[model samples]
Target: MKQTYGYQQKARQFFAVLLPIFITQLSLMATGFFNTIMAGHISQQDLAGVAVGVNLFLPFFGSVLGIISGLTPTISQLYGGGRQDKIGFIVKQGFYWAMALAFLFIAVGWLAVPRVLPLLNLEPKVHYITAHYLLAVSFGIVPIFLAGVLRNFIDAHGHTRLTMCITMTSVPVNIALNYVFMYGLFGVPAFGGIGAGIGSAIAFSLNLLLNVWVVTHIEPFKSYRIFHHFPRPQFSEWKKQLGVGIPIGSTMFCEQSIFGAVGLFMTVYGTVVVAAHQAAMNFTTIVYMVPLAVSMTLTILVGYEVGAKRFADAEQYIRLSRVLTMVFVGVLALLLTQFKTEIAALYTSSREVQPILTGFLVYAVFMQVSDSINAPLQGALRGYKDVHVTFLLAVLSFWVIGLPGGWMLANWTAVGPYGYWIGLVAGVLVGAVCLQIRMGQVQRKFSGQEG
Candidate 1:
């Protein structure tokens, strides 16, 4: 009875963390969903342009988010260890790091967008939209990164509902802004596809504002006094975060960039194919938020336990998270397979795009299953601060093994665009196996030390 009660309590705690995180993640992905849907309505070319541009942008943006994510485990561990006073300083340093990265990405966008888009030989309008869209979104990079630092701090403190409310508030605002700029409402002129980027920038800025307000006004958060004083960049502090963060950022880059690379490859098959690929990918990404949230919750819960020297508790959370994640993703994969045609229709009415989109969703089902294992395990490892190995595995799986295999099958075999999707499935499965093995080793090592 005692053990059963303990497990029940743990499960409830897990869902308490998972629920808000899932909603926050779902809300965040909704912005992208609307972006893709609205862009598709304009024209297939517009859809392709935005798709390519997003693919190009995500690797950089995801890296920023991943690097800042270091703060979540770091802060959670601090909180668990009864060292709450230290969080403000770490967050302040994170801001400096985020600012630097934001500017660096902006510079890269300016110098690289023109040179890179032309190489793809995209349609002139598509190229124009893609270039201008990237430029417009560049405006919000700083705010987005800054907000990320704050959100992580808040989430690590177990105030996930606060972040969820903030994000949910931003979605409607983002949709309104997306509509205003994309179709041109009231006094605003239609920016077409470029408007999506503009809306995102404004929305991202709003997110930052909301995060700032929460951290400043909220009770426990307000007590942290993160903004009490801004400090100069501390190299020692930066190095400490970088030790954990760089690998995290790199791992995210590898995973996100693989999709971008796949999207870019789809362009060769023409606009319709590219758009369909994006739609399928977009839906799968929405479903992806579940495991991602589970993974993130694992990071927080496990980090808290590890910091408190509760190794047994951390292992239990790990096991519990994996079981729940696999079951949830399994159900999602079924729904995706069952309603693929309907889901595909959500992106576009064109019969040409619909069939292709459904086909891609089939491959996505497999990827989601693989992610169920790897994603949360990766999160558990992050809790252990065991990031370097995962980074190497990501590279070996996605870039070294996945990309090359996809390219060969794509070009040489009859698989065509489907070949790339297959490669994605293979890569994720490889990463999943390796990550499971790595997590096992870490769990035993920690548990043994505790014993």
Candidate 2:
């Protein structure tokens, strides 16, 4: 007889996995929150500079992170299938790939960002700050990628809390560094907005160190000997991971770069609009951690179950996660609606920016609801290793539909800045519908195979 899961049993397990991942995601998002808040307090120009800088960096970073993230599903499946011995060697290959990619990312950012920022015709001060910020943050790229590999390995083993503890511990350190570097405390010269990058670099380094400590010294993981017997780079292993990773990375790039593209486009709307846009984007992103946590957790669980050939259980996990995400996001929408003013206050004190920021938050409630549906479905599909089609879908939704539509509306219509967000809402809804259908097809295929 095949093992079965009850609703209550599934919910317990889901929360067990989801809570740690949620806390971990929150801790990670908090670092960005600190960066934004600190820069905002410095000055509107500083805040806007940080916004453009981060917008330039994150899409590329998201792509790199997405590629590295391929390790999680692969590792989860391997662990679930009882192929524990192959895990360490695989992670070694992932590390090699991460190092190579880190160098590539730093090179591209250094070479390309300066050349590109000038094309946007930003304020001279903002442009200078943006350039320096990316330069400073570049130092942390290698450690961030390496830490990503280890964190994925740990999370794949259902050890999310360990990574959470590691990340959470870094928060205070990140804040202290942010304060000192941003404000020039304790004899340190204030680099202003650029200091946010420096603080983040040091924090990323700290995270890497802590991840190394945990994997090397902790139970279960220590036995894997991930640090021992390092294997050389293999093209075949790279191909396997890249095969899954590239599409995922491409999809992430499309989705994230749209915002970056919008930020650049918003340059014409003036600095105040750009600052408000970033603030709104920042808060929505923090709220997004909830569904993102669900998505990530589903990826782990569904991948594990699929690897174990437990198709029914995998389906159950997907269904439960979607429902839970809906409920959570609904509550968040209420909070966003009720406390829009307070939330805006958290990001900036600018009277000019505050009302605009609050309006954007209203739009976020809709965007996030669609994202609740979109994120987890993608997570479930990734667990099934159904990535290529989703890549196409992402391009269609975010680029073919979202970006062009937003541009037209923003330029040709009355919506102005809000037009881009409306396009986001439409794009995500389309993606969600398409993904829902695609997920159904995958489930049927799996269910038939099981039958």
Candidate 3:
């Protein structure tokens, strides 16, 4: 009875953290939706160009979110376990890692972004806007890192809603900034796609600045050693972080790459078709973000519970997080399925674009469920420090079933883009199952160790 009661308590604790995180993630993704709508209004080419630009840079972008996210569970576990002194080292190292990564990506993108443009068969007009967008977004990378690390750190200490406030506080500003810049309403020159990128950068900067202010001034956080001195990167810690961080980041990169490759492959059919495809996919991505927030928040909770040696409570919370995530995703799926036509139509004015996207709308709901399940599973595994196997699982599922399967079904067969996305479905299923299996195995092993 005591164990059951304690399990229920932990589950509630998980939701308390998960709900606000979901809201924050939803708001962040809504920013992308706003950008898409704004860009879609400008021109179809502008939207497609944004799609291409994002894929080209996504692996790098995922790396920043990945690296700093490494600190979340580690710091959380330590704090929840009552090891206050060591938290400073983790924060410092994460900050340093963030700055280092920002400089590297900026240099690479600046030198190579122009070179990358012509490589794509883009319209002459899109070439300039895309280049400018790439440059502006790059400047936000470090601030993005700062924002991610801060959010993770805040969540670790059970002050989950603080990060939500920062992100939520920025949404209206982000939307307004987009309108101002994209349409040249504020006496600014009309920059189109580039304007959207600039708005995102400014919003990111604002949120990051706010995070710094609150984390330094706030209770529990103010007392942490990171405020006084950042931790020097120790191999013991870095290796531990790498252990948890690499597979996660790699899984994200792999998953994003698979879907990204799908968009790339669609280019084989033609640009407009691909543009429509991107519209549907982006819409679906925004939906998935809400569940992603749940998954991330659960990771923090699971980490804390595990660190305190409450294995059963940790296990129960994982199950609860998955349940809550599925419910949220299912609700979204129903809403998207009903109004996909309405949503896809908003992205394009053409008759041809609508039909192609219509065929893929049903897949969006499936992708959400698959993604929603897989995300929290990844979080649970990371909380258990079980990431190394995730690398192999992602590769196998993505390359073996998804990439190759997609190629075979789409190219060799006459199934078209639908056939290609079928492979994505298969990939998601495979990833979900494998990740769950791995998580269970790790949990069992961990339970025995705890015993």
| Candidate that beats the other on lDDT, 1 or 3, i.e. the better one | 1
Cα TM-score of candidate 3: 0.88
**Top lDDT model:** 2
- Per-candidate TM vs. native? 0.90, 0.90, 0.88
Ranking by lDDT: 2, 1, 3
Q: What's the candidate order when arranged by decreasing TM-score?
A: 2, 1, 3
Clashing pairs in 1: none
lDDT (C-alpha) at residue 252 in model 3 = 78
Q: What lDDT tens digits, residue by residue, belong to model 1 across residues 48-81?
A: 8887788788778888789889888898888777
lDDT of each: 0.87, 0.88, 0.77
Q: Which residue pairs collide in model 2, if any?
A: none
Task: State the lDDT of candidate 2 residue by residue for 1-451, as single tens digits.
Answer: 1234787887887887889889987777777777888999999889989988887788889898999888888988888788888899899999999899999999888889878999978999999899998999999999989999999999887788888898889887988897899999989999999998899899889999999999989988899998888887998999999888888899888887788777778879998999899888877777888888898888888888887888888998888987898898889888987899999999899999999999999999999989999999999999988899999999999898988898899999999989898988899999999999999999988885552
Clashes of 2: 0
